[model samples]
Target: MFVQPMWLVMLSWAVLFVGLASTAVVVVDQFVLGYRQPVKVMEMVWPVNALYLGPAAVLGYRKWGRPQSPRWLDRHGSPPRRSLNARTTIKACHCATHCTLGVLIATPVTYGFGLEMFGSTLWPEVVGDYVGAAAVGVAFRYYTEARTGGRRAWAVMRKFFMRDLLTVSVFEFALLGWLALMHFVFFHETLRPNGPVFWLIIQAGLIIGFFAAWPPTLLLTRRGVETELLSTPQ
Candidate 1:
C-alpha cells in the first residue's frame, strides 16, 4: 500500500540514471582514458562522489581534480592556483568518500538480509557504515604513509588514523541525522535500494553531509590538526 507518487518515482529515477552516468564518465576518464589523478586516494574519491553529486561531480572534477593529474600537469606545465575553499572541499571529500562507501554498502546489505537490531535497520546500518569507513579510511592512510617511507611511517599513519576517526564521526553524525529524518518523517520505508527513491534518499543525504562536515574539516585544517590530505600526493 505504501508507494511514492508516480511523478516522484519518475524524477528520482531520472536523477539516479544521471548520477550513474556521471559515475561512468568519471570511471572511463580515470581508468580507460588515463586521466589518472596524481594522488592515489582521489582516484577513488572522484568516482565515489559522482554517484551522488551527478554532473556536478564531473564539473568539479574538470575544474579542480583534472588539473592536478599528471596528464594535465604535463600538458600545462603546472597546476593552476586554487582557493582555500577548493582545498578544504577536496580534503573533506577524502573523508566523505569513505563515509559514502560505507553507507551505500551497508544500506542494501542490511535491507537485503533483513538485518535488524532492536526494532529497525538503523543500528546495523550505522555499524556497517562506520566499520566500512574505518576500513577504507585506514587504507587511505596507509597509502599516504607508504609514500612517506620511514620507520616513522607507522607513526604518521597512526596520526592519520586518529584524525580520520574524528572526521568520520562528524561526517556520519550529520548524515545519520539527516537520513533518520528522511526515513522516519519524509519518505518512510516504502522503497528498496533497487528503486530510485531509495537512491534518491541517500543521494540527498550525502549532499547534505558534505555541507555538514565542511566546517569541522576547515577548522581542523586551519588549526593544523590534519595535514596529509592537502600536503601529500602520489
Candidate 2:
C-alpha cells in the first residue's frame, strides 16, 4: 500500500468539500428561486463553476447568474448593463466550467485504465478529457433547453451537439496546451492525475481556457447559435 503525504490528503479533502458544498448551493438556488426558467444552461454552469471557484461561484450567481427584474432593478439602481462582449465572456466562462469538471472527473478514471490506448503517453488522458468534456457539455445543454422549452427535440439536440463541440474544443485546446507546457517545460515530470499539484495546474488551465473560448462564444452568440442567459438591464 502507498501512503500519501498528510498535506496532500488534507488539500484533497478541502477541494472535495468546497466542490460539493458550493455545487449544492447552485442547485438549491435553481430550484427555489426559479432561476432555471430564465437562465439558459445555468442549471449546469453554476454548479460546475462552484466545483473549482467555491465561494466565488456563489458571488457570481448573485451578481450575474440571476435574471433581471423590476425588484432587482430598483435595488441595484439599474447599473449599466453588460455589453455583448462581456456577456460573451460570461458564456465562455460557463462553457469552460463545464469542461473543467468533466476533465477532473475523467482524469482519474482514464488513468486507472492505463495510458496505452494511444502511442503517446498522454494521448489516452487527452482522449478521456475530450470525451468527458463533450459529453457533459452536450448533456447540460440538452437538460437546460428541455426545461426551458424549445424547438423540436431533434433540432435542440443537433444544435447543442454542434455548439458544444465548437466550445469544448477550444476550451480543451487551451487547457491541454497549458498542461503540456507545465508538464514538459516547467515541472519536468509526469503529472499525476490524482495529485494536488495536478489539480492546481488544471485550475489555472480552466481559467486560461475561458479566455481562449471567448471569441468563439462571441461569434456564436452574435449569430444566435447560443443564447445569453443573463440580460442587460434597460
Candidate 3:
C-alpha cells in the first residue's frame, strides 16, 4: 500500500486559504474605510495562521528532516530549463503561494500579538497577527523568485544569500519599526516601563527583528537542497 503525502498538501492548502482570505479581508476593509490599516488587519488574521503554521512547520520539518522532501525539491532543481511549462508552473505556484502566505502570517505575530494583547477580548487581533507571519514566508519566496528568476529560484537562493537576507531583514525591521513608531508617537504608548529607556528598547527591537527574520530567510533559500533530494529520492 502506497502511503500518501496528503497531510503536507492539506497543511499547505490551509495556509494558502488563510493568507489569501486575510489579505483580501484587509484590502476590502481598507477600501471601505479609506485607509491603510495594515497593522489592525494583521492583528486579526496572523494569529490563526500561527496556530496552524507553527504546528505544520514542526510536522513538515520532522517529516522532511535529514532525509528531506526530495520530490518537491527535484521539481525545482531538474534541468532542461523549461519555461512556465505545466510542471514548472505548478512548482513555482506552490513556492509563490505558500511563501506569500508565510509572510502574511509573520508580520502581525511579531508586531501585534505580544504579551500586551494577551488579555484583550479581541481574539481576532491575536489570530491575525500570526497569519501575517505565514505571509512573510510567502512573500520571501515570491519576491525572491519574482525579482530574480522563477526557473532559477534555487540557484539564486544559493548565490545571493546576503542579498536575500538583506531584503527580508530590511522588510521585517521596517514593518516592525513602523508599527512600534506608530504606537510610540501616535498612540503615546511605550514598551519600556522607563520613558528614557524606551528609545533604546525600540532600537533593540529593530535589531532583533532583523535577526529573527534571517533564519527563515536562509532556510527558504537553502531548502534548494530539497530539490536535488526530491529528484533523486533516496
* Winning candidate number (TM-score): 1
Worst 10 residues of 3 by lDDT: 225-234
Q: What are the clashing pairs of model 1? A: none
lDDT, each prediction: 0.79, 0.69, 0.37
Quote the lDDT for 211 in model 3.
Answer: 44
TM-score of every model versus the real structure: 0.90, 0.71, 0.25
Per residue, candidate 2 scores C-alpha lDDT tens digits across 7-50 of 86577667767767988887887777555524446656778777
- Candidate 2 residue 5 C-alpha distance from true site, Å: 13
Worst 10 residues of 1 by lDDT: 225-234
For candidate 2, the per-residue lDDT at 31 reads: 74
By TM-score, the better pick of 2 and 3 is 2
Model 3 scores what on Cα lDDT?
Answer: 0.37
For model 3, how does the per-residue alpha-carbon lDDT over 154-221 read when each residue is reduced to its tens digit?
55455334333343434344535554564546435533222323233333343344345444544554
Off by over 4 Å in 3: 1-103, 107-160, 190-234
Q: Could you give the candidate ranking by lDDT, starting with the highest?
A: 1, 2, 3
In model 2, the worst 10-residue window by lDDT is 225-234
